[model samples]
Target: MSVGLVVVSHSAKIAEGIVELAGQMAPGVRIRAAGGTDDGGLGTSFDLVMSAVVDADDGDGVVVMCDLGSAILTAETALDFLDDELRARVRIADAPIVEGAVAAAVAAEVGGALAEVVDAAEASAAASAMTSDQNSPEEAVESTSSDRRGSDLSSTTLPPSSERPEEPIGANATLINPSGLHARPAAEFVRLASTFDARITVNGVDAKSLLRIMGMGLGIGSSVRVEATGTQAQEAVDALTTLLASGFGE
Candidate 1:
């Protein structure tokens, strides 16, 4: 079974709606919603959160996402009561509830382990915050470069597709998915990209970031430039190009 997810929100409707939205992209994952007081008022419920954590766990692990401060406190309290063994496999992610749930769900759907699922949720929040403040991809690359000082900079730091040298293994394909790289399709693309061992970029954006891919705003007929570097570079490029050409089974 895949890693499960628990969404804790002050409003039951908000929690359930996030679950439904994330579930659309990850049908195989079990995502539970814990929201509102036991009396059906808008507030956190320790019992509901505890029950959801138990129900969502399927041996793999569980990742919890919260909406507000008190919701996190409720989740933490629930976790405190879990058996030690089960508690070891669960995590409460500090992330935006909706985006984090979606990213975590997709990662789990693709067989990510406990830590990877939590990382996906937190990473999505970080990526969102960074992208929101930048006006263009160049600014993003610049930020990445500045941040990498004193750290290992890899070949993936190549300039945008327009300025990069000819890659031995790269391909371009037109989006055939009627909706193009919308939320579901983009998530699928990111999920597939993450499976490879190469550093890949699609049209200059990190291939494994859901937020970055969606930010491209690529629609039907948009040309996709996929390039990769590393042992699995060729395989990564070929698979992504084929998926793009196949319309992502839309």
Candidate 2:
């Protein structure tokens, strides 16, 4: 089963808007928005957050994303009131609300576990920061590796390819979709990349990260190099190249 998500914000519109954006990439994942007070004012509500946690939970666990300080406080207080069993499965992601929710939703949609979903959320911020700091793909990969290694909750890192000595499987494909690698197409590419038992890179960035793929800002007619290393390298490269050649079914 897929993990679920909850978006908690001080403004109802903000929370709902985030949900709408994330939902475009993850239509099947359950994403509940807990925004504003019960009276529809501009404040967080413990009751609203609590109910959202319950509604979003689907036995796989829930990742909660908060907008501001008070929203986090309300979510934390709500978690405190939950039973020990339920509380064990809930996590308050240390991430930006919009980016975190989108990343978490895409991870959950791809059947990631609870910890992986949390990692996706937290990594969103870290990836953005690194991209802004160093615009090179090598730097992005190094930053991701360092962050994943440092995080206590990160159980998964980029698949290892050091043991294999041969050259990685590679292919080049042009973006034919009118919108290029936007949110939805990027999410689809990431989802496909995650299914393989290989380390894949598109234009040198981690292929399995939704945020990294979108951050590349590829446009229509842009040529992308897809490469992979590991046992399933050929399959991963073939699948991705085929998808890109097909215009991502647009």
The candidate that wins on TM-score is 2
What is candidate 2's lDDT per residue for 1-250, written digit by digit as tens?
A: 6798999999989999999999999998999999999999999999999999999999999999998998889999999999998899999999999989999999999998999999999999998876576657887899899887789546655456875466888999999998898889998889899999999999889998888888889989999999999989999999999999999878
Candidate 2 residue spans exceeding 4 A from truth: 136-165
Residue 237, candidate 2: how far off, in angstroms?
A: 0.7
TM-scores, each model vs. reference: 0.85, 0.87
lDDT against the true structure, per candidate, is 0.91, 0.92
lDDT, candidate 1, equals 0.91
> Given candidate 2, what's the lDDT at residue 2?
76
lDDT of 1 by residue, 113-137 (tens): 9999999999987888766766778
Clashes of 2: 0
**Pairs of colliding residues, candidate 2:** none
Clashing residue pairs for model 1: none
